[model samples]
Target: MDIAFFTDRRNDLGESPVWDARRGWLWWVDIRLNRILAADALGVVQREWTYSQPVGSIGLAMGGKVLVAAFADHFALIADDGHAQPIVAPDIGEGAIRFNDGKADRQGRFLSGTMQHGGQAEALAGVWRLERGGSATRLETGMKLANSICFSPCGHWLYLSDTLEGVIRRYAYDPETGALGPREAFFDCNTIGAAPDGATVDSEGRLWAALVTRQQIGCISPEGELLRTIDLPVPFPACPAFGGADMATLYVTTIADSGHKLKSDHPDAGRMLAITGLGARGIAEAIYHT
Candidate 1:
């Protein structure tokens, strides 16, 4: 598929591509830069917001606000005016841990995962669920790089990836009670020599995952079969989201290579990419309940 540039500016670690249907804009974050950006469908800059600490990911919430997983240490609700209110603050003791990738579940509960900063090997990282009334619960633990958090279209399964291990796992999910059963190995990327970074489910229930090291996105059948791959110009595609007027466009966020070398080698390494004519549509993103 042909990829088009959606942004000129580059991000050090651009992750978390989300579509704000209510505002008709695409939103994403530059994790290292601690900035959140919103742009129009035509790749025009609409607005930019920055926070005091690294903003890992964002989930659309009611009242024109966004639920933010900030600095991997806390969760907050941020408004368009840049005002924020603390929701849940988990004490991740002094270590190299911080939030990385996340999204809302089918039932509007916000879920985020943590990663060891600088790729350090630490067992403190894990996945968390932010309950409706500002409560936090640890869902999974003993992870190094938690990523690729997405739910099945039927809302019956939850998928997560441990990038460091190069494997993605699936869990039986309860949309109503936010309960997750034991995880089972879904796909192993080791054979492909790549790690799964981020993912999203399409309207047809196919899982599209960003293979960061392989420079492509893999579309897997709901039954865990390899379906197809979408090649990208850059080497590090951090995350993918389905957006656009008809939700047929696939938006991807990439990160700059080590020492920003890809900025010269690829040029489009950190810029957002929009892929169209994919012959598939995306399910609407679930809004976070306050």
Candidate 2:
């Protein structure tokens, strides 16, 4: 119900956010800044690591000291001291194809999707799964702007969406086989005139989606009903995560000026934000087992 600024510095395009329960720190990425950052609970940026390629998204590792990251063209395990171990380079094709939103499933497999820079109609993007021993597999294809990826707490459902399609699809997940059953159109963001961006699941199994095109965060019930919408302070919210000691605080990342190729000077546009008093708690994010 209340949106508060969490950080002072602005992020050009902040994306995926994950909370590390072991360290009580929140980690996120500035997609265009080519960096991964971790902040303490008090909003102090503890670690800022920059790389040659963009850090598309990040996931917690089993020990909580190392992080699993989805780089622009590959996946890597980054240590607390900023050391990076290059993992397998997924076959995402060439030219403008790069990784985007990603999250680890309940089974400890890291799942990330790619986005084609200019091929919206071709649907050249896909979702890939990475196992503990560094094995990779392409699970699904035919996506445009891969976003809104998360799994239910019970590990039975996986949610995914392409920002350009305006539709979020839910897949029946089989953890043992690492296979996804046929997907069904779970919810249409077009109904709200907003495209869903990065999303997460609450302990109650509700999906909280960042409505990028609109200045709002939409919460949908597990049955695919839009339960309510929360007003956002900025126009382009990139993602949301549940953190804090109690997992009751909702943190959101945003896009500042030059976002979507547009320019604006809203003071709080690109800063990290926190929302509280919602009385909702979140399930612990699945860690990527090494």
**Candidates' lDDT values, in order?**
0.85, 0.88
Query: How well is each residue in 1-290 modelled by candidate 1, as lDDT tens digits?
Result: 56888978787788899998877899998887888888987788887878788888888888657545555589998877767788878765466778879999988889999887555555778899988777888899998889999999989999999998999999999988988899899999887787899999999999999998889999989999889888888778999999988999999999885233334356666888889988889999998877
Clashing pairs in 2: none
Model 2: per-residue Cα lDDT over 1-290, one tens digit each: 68898878689888898989988999999988888998999999999988998888889886544789889889999988988788899888888789999999988889999988764558899899888889889988998779999999898899999988999999999988888899799999999898998999999999999998888888999999999999887778889999999999999998885235634488777888899998799989988997
- Each prediction's TM-score against the native? 0.95, 0.97
How big is the positional error of residue 288 in model 1, measured in Å on the Cα after superposition?
A: 0.6
lDDT of 1: 0.85
Candidate 2, residue 119: lDDT: 43
| Candidate 2 minimal-lDDT segment of 10 residues | 256-265
Runs of candidate 1 exceeding 4 Å displacement: 118-122, 257-265
